[model samples]
Target: MELAEKLFHKSRREKLSSMLDENSLVIVLGSTNVARSYDDGYKFKQNKNFYYLTGFNEPNAVLVLAPGGMEVHDEKSKKIKKTKEILFVQKKDPLRETWVGRRLGYSNVKKELGIDTGMVNSKIGDVVADLISRDKYNKIYISLFDLNFLTGEVKEQLRGFESSWITLSTNVQIMDVNFLLAKMRSVKNEFEIEQVRYASTVTAAGFYNTIQMIKPDMFEYQVQALLEYHYKELGCQDVAFETIVAGGNNTCILHYNTNRNKLKSGDLLLIDSGAEFNYYNGDLTRTVPVNGKFTKEQREVYQIVLDAQYDVIKKIKPGVKLTDLKKYSVERLKKGMQKLGLLKKGFDVTKYTLHGVGHHIGLDTHDAVANKSIGKNDYDKLVAGNIITVEPGIYFPEDAKEIPERYRKIGVRIEDDVLVTKYGGEVLSDSLPKEIEDIEFLMME
Candidate 1:
């Protein structure tokens, strides 16, 4: 990380510490390495909350924030009083380091990362037990996900410990800390905004590279591989989520990942993918002709989706709720579909539009604070620094009887990343051409 980036993380930790009560303790657990096979494990991803607070990516670590007046025992058994933030990390093991890589082992964390103290992971349970045993803390904020992270033996010990603690202490309480982190993460700071911008740029470049190389008879996975290869070569560690590259009718299947079909001349290809940079993510989706030219039916459906998406994005600003935007999108689509004679009597949108119109994008592609409900007015108000995706899609299955035969097996989705600003929404992905002529022209090049 750059010096400025390191300072940004340090300031974030300080801000979190300031939010705590004087007698409160916060424990955030890092993610563990999940086994994929015997002696092999999947790539470890640190908990987003832990990373946001500490910027430390090591697995099996815990960040403990102790506010002022916490009691501690010194080497001589003397009672010491101080406020401290401690990082409990894996103990130094020469054999393990040899197998993997050198661990930042229990030293200089304070000097390097601005943490107050560092300790071995083995002593975390004992140290935490001793601190709470004194009844100094009135409230304990713990990651709810941490319970799932414990090993079997450690979890058994924790169950027993909780039972004993419940019997002994009436004032101490455990509370979910994720809500606070979610609220904090909902708004992007300057540093986070820059990272997301870079991610979006890379994502767009990858899409352009793939679209230029796309042609009839190319397998769907080949396109995905090409885009991902471009992303990795540009220094991205990993994708934000599983890459979705669907061709023709496969695009009707939301969240599809089986990129096995060979592209055909008249079919459309839908790709939904994103890149992660410095832990922030960019989500983008684009549907284009397999032969680089949209047919008549494909163009009609694509135009409706594009118009609906544009209307929704134009309305974004501080205090605009996503639910309102969704409703507006439905109305826009309904009117467009009706004008095009796709609607019969009622406005049943599920026939064409399948999923939600948009979602907040940040640390997670579908960010933690993105409103998830379909209730009429249930949603979060957009705020400046909030980054989201405006995606509107229409899918027509081959077997459907309501639509014309010419429109069958067509899927079109136009997605773009937007950032909420005081003036309105700034389209972060505006550089990527969504206009039909622009796309065809670029493909020609």
Candidate 2:
């Protein structure tokens, strides 16, 4: 990591420490591996909050942050020091190292992660217990997710803190660390924006590649594979979320990921997928005709969704409420649908205009940010550095008798990642074509 990158993590830690009240400690645990089968396990992914604070990747690591300084013995230095931050990492094991990847090893924590103190995780359990029992800190803030999935020495020592890391463990008031982390993660620094931008950039390339290669008779999963190839080919860890390559009637299913159907000439494909770059993610959705040409009815419906999306995106500056934006998009889509005679006075536009206009996209594709629920999302205005998606979709299932045969089984969703700016919204995935003419030209090429 560069100096700026290292400073980013350090500054976040400092800011969080400032947010803490005196006589309190915050404990956050990183993620551990899960077994895919009996022999091997899935890839280890560090908790986003932990990574934000330390940029450390190793699992079974615990981070302890005290508002005021605490005196602790540093094994590597063999000296007593006052520090507010301590990291407990795995001890060195040559055999384990040979089988799995190398550990950061506690001794290198300060140098590598910039934490003030480092200790082997083996002693963390007793250390935490001793501190709590001493009554020095009146409150403890721990990551709720980690508290549930505790393991190793920490779990053994704090065993039964299950009600809260250990059932009836201590008198200290326990609080969740997620609330603070959510508020902090909601905004982006320049580095985080760049991470998402690059991810969106590559993600756009992935869509660009997939749309051109798609043809009648190709399996939907094959298009998914070609799209995911952009993940590895463009320096990404993986797809941030499941690649939704829904075709024909499958497009109406909001969270559909069963990409097994064979594509037909007239059927449209709705792809809502993203790529992960450095944990920050890029979410995008684009619906294109499998035959490389949209019939007149298909073009009309696509235009309605596209125009509504454009109307919503233009209002994305700071101080604008997302819910208001969502409501506005809903109204705009209804008006658009009304023109097609699809939305009448009695009909609910929601049947076709499924989902909100957009959402904040970051560490997770749906992001671990604030105001996830439509009406109650953070209840705060969007400030600059907040990245969001603008996706307005219309889905029409084939069975709907009210719909014309040509427009039935037609679903259109146009999505792009947008960074909320002081001036206006900047589309990060601009490199990928969204205009109907552009898409058709690319397919022709």
Candidate 3:
């Protein structure tokens, strides 16, 4: 890790520590390996909140942060003054390491992660129990979820200790650390924005490459495989989520990932995917004609969705509310649909235009922040450094009698990752072509 990123994570932990009252303890538990089959396990993904604070990726680890003025006893049982931070990792096991991978052990964690103290997992319950018995902590903050990965004999002991501590101490309060961390992560820092931009660049490249390769009669899984291959070749450890390569009416089913159908010549293909760089994710979606040219009806609906996306992106600036933007984008789509004669008087456009226009994107796609709500005074305001998506779509299933014959079974959506700025919004995925002419030109090869 770069020195700057190390400092950035350290500052985040310090910020959280500063937010707590005196004699407060924050417990962050890492995720454990889950069995994919009998003995083999799925890839380990660290808990996002734990990764946000500690920058430690290993499983079955715990990070404890105690604010200043907390009395703690070290391994030697000697009293220590001031703040304390301890990271507990699994002890070295040659057989386990040989089977899977080498363990970092406690010594390396302290040096590499810049943690104040590091100990084996077995010691955590005893140490925490000692602190509780001594009445050293007034407030305890733990992960909000009932984490399935957080299990073992050590954890059982700690759980027992916590239950007893709560029963004994009326003054001690337990709080959810996830809430505090969510508010901190809602806004991106400079390093985080840089990472997102890099991820966005890679994501756009994958889309452009796939666009050039897409052809009539190609299987949907083939397109998914090609795009994912490009993402990995460009240096992304993995995709942020499952790649969605929906062609024809399959595009109407949002979140469709069973990419097994063949592409039809006149159908529109929607590719909604993103790449992850250092855990930062870039979410992008684009729809294009399968045979490199749109028909009259397809072009009409595409243009309307494009206009709505373009207008929504223009309104993305600090202080703008998401609800207001959604309403504005819907009105734009409604007018466009009415002009096309798809809707009668008083017909609601939202019937065909399902889903929200966009959402915040960051460490996780559909970032943890709440969207700006309905009321003018009751919404979250867009702020600089906020990363979001601007996606607008019009879906018409084949069975809809109200829909026009030519436009049936057609779905078109255009999405881009945007970074909110003081002056305006910056398009992070602009490298990928969204214009009709540009897309056709690139696909001509």
Candidate 4:
């Protein structure tokens, strides 16, 4: 299903209501971008948090939820409560639609979004003012830090009636809605998981296709072009992030996106890329030898990274903290590097294994989660339905004299997307070959 079709408003409202005390009014603001000149014009993407809550992708919108309103009786003798959700949208405009695009006015928004009521944007000031004027609602919950159109207008209204008897007595509180929204988006729903799976599948195809088309003499940019072509052909809206096509010694740079290098006979090419589908993303990385085969030294380093990655994958399940995973992977890398003699008897292993093994992936590549620190007993357990990456890498530059001569100038990273589950972690991007023999075979094809 399309993102816009999801019924996220109810869950979002529940979360907001849970956070707020009784008698509070919460307002979310969204607006269209208006450039000063034609040359500076740009398209606007709907705020991810706002879109996550309401599934409203259009610009110039507001969502209001009043928790403490007077209860009235209806004709059926049932208690008909006051409005819980009120949406304000842009008024219909023919001229604007001609230049830009058609907008679903108030009527359509109410029916489609399942809100209690919908109104014109022009009347928002009056409606909000009246709602605040009521003496019963003492606490007002407005997203203070957001400087969008609705927030600015609400601020002006609050300033306008600051001296009035009703407004002066009312206690208004500002809440950081961004934090509340981030917590909501950390866990993935069934629909969201499905969309992410589709994106991962397409991304895997792109990686496989790009690898098959790669030649020893091809420019890195040409390989990047092939990956992009496959992404588009597989119906990806766009790349999740800039494509990284680092080759040879350049792979030592973690985020090398400059695809200007030439693939030599003995160099390894590393690609870290993914595709975006329905605003969800999939992240994967694979490193392969440019000449369809890895040198003995390259295979040694590659096998170690692969082993670390596999060990982490086997331990991924519910209640697995990211910190423990990091420690475990580091220990494995340290042992592997020790066997290879890269580290002396007691040298700190972190010097070689620098970055974290993985991170959350979703609407944004680095999606939010509860874990803030990597402590020994950190309780940020891996919950079911959360998508994460398991990437293990070893980078050794040419200047590092401690390593063997053949192992120098070699960087190998293998990453894959995984979905946490109750039984065990499911490897979403398993279609891509990670084994040394399999990669060599595919490259030969």
Best of the candidates, TM-score? 2
Q: Which residue pairs collide, candidate 1?
A: none
lDDT per residue as tens, model 3, 1-445: 5677668778888999999986788888888777899978888887777778778888888888887644555553345634478888888999999988888888776568877777788877887777777776789898758343466644664775666865855878877887777677778999889989999999999999889989999999999899889989999988889889999999899999999999999999999999988888988998999999989898899999998898899999998987788888889999999998899887778888898888888888888754544554333688888888999889998887788788998998899999999999999999998988898898896
Model 2 residue 151 lDDT? Answer: 58
TM-score of each: 0.93, 0.95, 0.94, 0.85
User: Over the stretch 1-445, how does candidate 4's per-residue lDDT look in tens digits?
Assistant: 2334446556667676787767777777764565658657545656566666677767767777776543322222345546677777777899988987887887776567766666666666666667666655666555445543434343454444334535454365545566566666767888788878988999999999889878888999999999989989999988888899999998888899989989898999999999988778889999999998999889989999999999999999988887789889888988898898888766677766668899888888877544554465333678888789999888887886777778888888899999998998999999999999988888885
Worst 10 residues of 1 by lDDT: 72-81
lDDT tens readout by residue for model 2, 26-126: 88887767678988888888888989998888878888999887777768677877789999888889999999989888888877777878888887776
The 0-to-1 C-alpha lDDT of every candidate, in the order given, reads 0.81, 0.85, 0.84, 0.77
**Deviation (Å) of 200 in candidate 2:** 0.7
* Residue 309, model 3: Cα distance from true site in angstroms: 0.9
Local lDDT at 173 for model 1:
77
User: Which runs in model 1 stand beyond 4 Å of their true positions?
Assistant: 73-81, 152-165, 370-379
lDDT of 1 by residue, 91-161 (tens): 78899999987788767566666666777777677778888778778888887677656653334434545
In candidate 3, which residue pairs clash? none
Q: What is residue 76's positional error in candidate 1, in angstroms?
A: 13
RMSD of each: 2.7, 2.3, 2.3, 4.7
